[model samples]
Target: MVDFYPLARKAEVLHVPMEVYLMFRAAGGPDILGQSAAVSLLDWFELDTEIIIVMERPSPSMDLVTYSTLHYPLPEDTVRDIMRQLVLAVIDLHNKRVFHRDLKSNNVLIQETEDGIRVRIISFGCGCIVSTIPYTSFTGCLSCAPPELFLERKYMDSPTSVWQIGGVAYELFNEDSKFFNTYEWFIDALGMKTSITASEEGKHFIQVCLEESPSKRISLEELERHPWFFTTT
Candidate 1:
């Protein structure tokens, strides 16, 4: 995939946001290349007014959104596998000091393999590095945005990511895409609202992800060890 970023928007800095972002990744280390969950960056160059980025194209792949829309309410085992991969990816990113602030179904590429399905996280436009300090600015889909980000505009990398992951999991399992319908459905889901239901395991998992208190939210490590993945057997 080739992405073009116009530098004219932020003429003062004269640096393309994406170009700078890629530069950081390039400097961060070569570990990204080994991460199965992230889309690999191939090459990037700067033009007069645009930054061109070349990335690996995952052939015969569709985004998770399309996949889910076509195959909503995916089987429990399928969802478990998907979450396992995603959690593994997030763990890798966190370990590498990269935070994908904008993780949603739209940018997650999905391709079927001989063994199973593969998922790659894309769209680093809203991503940043992990820091001891909290981030104040937020990006990505409002529906997938965590409550802490919306309410306080301040969020930590790990907890916020947990929320999105949980939201995606719930959406896939329930075949409901109104993740951002915070006014009604989301509010209910957070409350474990009786009207909006899921499997007992599903509900427990979602609750852990959507915990209102960021500090109490499930960590990537904890999620990886969750019982949900073991249920498939």
Candidate 2:
């Protein structure tokens, strides 16, 4: 997979994606859902103004946005399976000490295998090394950013990462989520809006992930254990 980014922004880009692939490979992390969740970055080099990234391209894949739009109004069980893999993918990155600050729907790729649907997280352009220190500047899609970035002007690792995961869910489950902001997210996430079609447990999972206060947001561990993942029907 070759991703093309604007030449103007090439100078500012870091090799976080490459770093993540390498680290995960070195750690020998197991695959998620019987397939490699990590998108391997073969190599990258800048040419004058633009940067060309060579990565592994999964056969017959589409981004999550396209996938979800194609399967519009995805059922809760399918959403549950997808989210389980997604959260696990996120946890895998965090475990490798990588922070994919921009974890929106567009960054995820979906592959339909003989067994089942598989998800691969792509685009580490907005990623960074995980650190205990908070990030004062945000490097992700503005509308997809978390409330802590707007409210406190700084975002820590766990809270912000968890929020981004929730943002992905919002995009999948909520109507008219394309133009959202933190304020809108604040009000809409208080509870599952009528536009969101989901079970009570699923609704609660998203609500907990998008809590207004950073302190109130769910941790990755808690998210994996969320009841929604285990709910049937």
Candidate 3:
């Protein structure tokens, strides 16, 4: 059995076999109500582990450290499996009318099961309800953030998670940051200066996910049916 006592003392303990922990801002607790709501939906579908809120602690100051060394290239089939799991998880969250707000590689946890790789979306500290007050500012990792998020605009309703997921997929496959690199040369190598393109199928899928117009972006349900995912053999 996984020893969760360390986590239990730090956060509220949910009654689940798997060890899960959640910590939220004391004053901003209501802002993250969507996470609890999403967790409920996952429980209904039997797809999420129970999350218990640990007691609030003073937010810690941390330094930014690039995770360039944490790369392990997986087989193509394994990558597809990870993507499938991520899509299913996101689909379930969208169906429940909750947006993750922050979706990045660090926020996602991967474990190997007897059947295959099991991916779990974690960290709901910044999540908010779909209908909550429109956010005027964005708060997330800049590397994986959508371009629109950087713009100073109120009432951003884009399904930004989709774009972040694509960034995650790119990182998984490349073992290096494509768009999220800090070095100027690395960013240039991504061919951002020119109109870089991928396969027809890849282009279609990535375009929808990275759509500049929030209204034009594809929904999770529609994304699950995209050829990039379905056509994978």
For every candidate, C-alpha RMSD to the true structure in Å: 5.9, 6.4, 11.1
* Model 1 agreement with the true structure over 12-47: per-residue lDDT tens digits: 433445534533452332345524667776666667
For candidate 2, the TM-score is 0.82
lDDT string for model 3 (71-158, tens) is 3445445555666677777766655444666776666655444654456555565655455456766665656656555553543433
The total number of steric clashes, by the backbone 3 Å criterion, in model 3 comes to 3
Each model's TM-score? 0.81, 0.82, 0.60
lDDT at position 202, candidate 2? 78
Point to the candidate with the largest TM-score: 2
Candidate order by TM-score, decreasing, is 2, 1, 3
Candidate with best lDDT: 2
| Candidate 1 pairs with clashing backbones | 143-180
Residue 121 error, candidate 1, Å: 0.9
Each candidate: what lDDT? 0.70, 0.74, 0.50
